[model samples]
Target chain A: MNVAVCVKQIPDSEPPALDPQHHTLVRDGKLVMDESDSFGVEMGLQLVEAAGGGEVVLVSMAPCGETRGLRTALATGAAKAILVSDPVLAGSDALGTAKVLAAVIRRLGPDLVLAGTESTDGYTGTTPVQVAELLGWPSVSFARHVEISHRALRVKRQTETGYEEVTCPLPAVVTVTAGVVEPRYPSFKGLAAAKSKPVEELTVVELGLDPSQVGFSGARQQVISVRAVKAREAGEIVVDAGEAHERVISFLEQLKIL
Target chain B: MDKTWVLAEQRDGTPAGIVLELVTAARGFGSVVEAVTWGPGGAGAAAVLGRYGVTKLYNLGDIGESLPGPKVAAAIAAQLAAESRPDAILIGATHDGRDIAARLSARLDLPVLANVVGMDASGGRLTSEHSIFGGSTVVRAEFTGAVPGLFIVQAKSFAAEAAEAAEQRSLEIVEVEVPDTGPSDAARVVTRHEEEHSGPKLDEATVVVSGGRGLGSPGNYALITELAQLLNGAPGASRAVVDAGWAPYAFQVGQTGKTVKPVVYIACGISGATLHVVGMRAAQYIIAVNKDREAPIFAIADLGVVGDVTKVIPRLIEAIRARR
Candidate 1:
């Protein structure tokens, strides 16, 4: 009864600016675990706890072979961590990412896998399903609630109209939506334990996967260019110490449709 | 004319509104448009296909009950394998639609472009335009695969319209063998609990009034609800507010939420994170009220009011009441 929760290390969403000339995010400082994955971590911990004696494992692929993001998840009470880091893994497309993650997940042999609906930076929302496809397992996306019973996984999946109740056996992939649950904060004891939690690092070759098939070399899509946008200038802002609402009404009147 | 396909969904035994919208979008590529869906109960639902001028309807017809995602994708792959592939496949970016697209991409060894706002066919390839980084920018990409380019277009991008005259189209009613994939077969819908809701759906509202973290507390959301009611608008919440439990998921408006193109969108106490802008940037006119003039919402707003929502909202309501 082990659960593998996939987490991502992302540049702060509110960065002052990306590196101007490089067309890349400024990863110079701390790269935090995306808040998007917090639900998955929390759900994984709760499920493992409900299962009586299982462990929640953290899995991630970080740039510059980083582990700070993994440590962030570990601080939430995950038992261990696995990171796939290699220079060759840089600039991979969603498919290439699914390939690397699938290979690693296959090796871990977890009964259930959880991932965020999408990363804040890359919200493609395709990698988890691709991983499921690659593993030849079942997949459920947009999951709002999940429960494990009788070697099966049941979920409340969000849809456009409303939602539906769905279930699949163990060894399936479920992508959790944000705000599904209130993620627990890392306790002081949990933070201390995370410092020593076993982190196993791996490369493409170690996983018996071809380096050529794991990264930029194998990517089917590439970003042609990224340019900083000159956002629209701020409009007429009326600072109303007490009459701001009246000023807004007059402004709307000026538009001839007040 | 090249053949194009739409993966349609059904609502209350009729083609869903978004499905018709997608069919309208597919009309741009070529005249030969078709639709694929499940459920035998939707035979009359097949007539809505005719109204959209879908020449052919590929109905798996409920081979698999609720977990029809994998089976539908399998049926599509089987069709593509057995016959000439369609030039493009347009799918709604709903939860089930994404599941179908993902499984199809995996089965076909092709990349599915998700979150496309618009699309075109050029030189035998489908070019997709996607909004990225909170809709401040957009990127154009083309699928370089063989036939059957997969696109998951965002909802509300295209307006749904019925054809001038309902054209009687060819119907291809074929049942597919639901392959028994081993354990971990995509989960099945065992039970359902829909949040009881009433009011205009968020994306369909002409007037939307949204709140954000600036509302201060969950209790403060009462102001937003009352303001929206006074304005005759649907209530929306920034992702931050919804994430903080001040509002429910249905009230969220932002990236990864509903993309709304209302006639007038009023922001109450919203700081306008780029993510929220990405979702509501299509509004015809935006009026934002935030005490901080530096809030990014002002950058795109037509009129910006620097005042607290609690103060400004009640005053505006009074003004509207006295004037009306």
Candidate 2:
């Protein structure tokens, strides 16, 4: 079995301040791999472990030096790391991003691919399905559990109501949710081993991707402007304990709730 | 002149609420809006679309008897390609909608904008509006590439238009031969488990009363339910409350759960995490009651009551009953 886990480096959700001018993430120079993607990495590792003998490949598309995230995946038991980096790949939207990933996966030729349900930064929740469509492969989103046999993959998908079990053949894509598996922390020994493992760097040109087929120019959607939400004016806090009871009654009556 | 298409979702023969909302939005862009439905035969799906002012309705008959994600997307994509080229296409931002929209975008080789709150078209370009950074910021986006721009509109962002009485006219239902997609070979729907509680759904409720970890345990959820009943609303919980087994997953509201846009959202014990706020920030009015005055929720709340939820909720419910 060959498993490929797609990871993305996103701005922390609780950023101190998103750059008001550029509409780009003002990381304060602090960047980390998306937490949800870590769950996918763990799921890939579990599948390989269950199969007894297989390769878990960690694939990521970030700036050249940002392979720190890929190295971190190697620390979590990924056998190898593949980084797709290029200067022209900046500011790519979901579609452009998926196109790059699909091209890379086509070259790698993996039996199964895993990705997080959504990236923390984009939050579009469309990458996995897009990649599957481009690859002409079956895709299952919001999967909570997955069991792979020789030629079949059984998965339990989390829906609005409950869970749905579905089985698909190999050469499929599965987008996992956070509750699927607990991600493991890098141990001292694992960290040492990761430093010695091989991490391959491939440029867009080296990967045989046409420059015209990637980045914001190739992206179909463009963001015109981004502005912070307007703050609301503070209302009076009913502090009087004796009058608090009466105030509550009056408030509910005013709103017509009573 | 090019027009826009709205892929209206229907259940049990009737168009869903968000379909009318999307129609109302498409009309704002000065484009001819077309409603398309795919379902079982004799479903009366087209008649329901007429009530929402859907001028052109396409009912793809019995393409495998069941409308799975991939088959429906492929059928619609093929239909659009054969017909007049649309300037933009909109879909509801539901679980099924997201899946189909991504596939459709790929099949059509178009760029997709997901979770759009609003849109505008000018000079042969469509600009979409989205709420990002946990609803703390709003962004306007457009595609500089080509026509038939694709987007998925967020549910509950726009109000559904009321049905108006109009003369009934016969609509042409174009049936397309959808290839045998083989049961979504991608993913299958196994079972749907309904929550035990029979209260109103949190997303559709006009008022929602929610509790957080401060509620202590599952036993104290009754207080939250009592307050919801008093207000004729629904009961909701934070992710922490759901993870602690105090509430079913259906009642949880946040980035991971359902996003709600209610008239009033009352928080009992929640500390107002950004993840939780994104789900409820669209509420018309917010009321936060917590012991800590500095809780993050107070910043976005219209009314803040600084006190323990156990003490405040009971008194608040009693006060409402007395007023009644």
- Measured against the true structure, the TM-scores of the candidates, in listed sequence, are 0.90, 0.90
Give model 2's docking category.
medium
Query: Per-residue CA lDDT of candidate 1, range B184-293, in tens?
Result: 35567776566535667788877788998888789989887776776667899998887787877778888777889988788988998877888898887888999887
Winning model by DockQ: 2
Which stretch of 10 consecutive residues in model 1 chain B shows the poorest summed lDDT?
B175-184
Which parts of model 2 have CA positions greater than 4 angstroms off?
Answer: A12-28, A238-250, B41-43, B62-67, B122-125, B163-170, B180-186, B243-246, B314-324
Candidate 2 on A150-201: residue-level lDDT in tens?
Answer: 7688887766666667778778899997757879999988888899888777
Q: What is the lDDT of candidate 1?
A: 0.78
lDDT of each: 0.78, 0.76
Clash pairs of candidate 1?
A165-B189, A166-B188, A166-B189, A167-B187, A167-B188, B39-B62
lDDT of 1 at B180: 58
Fnat of candidates, each listed: 0.55, 0.60
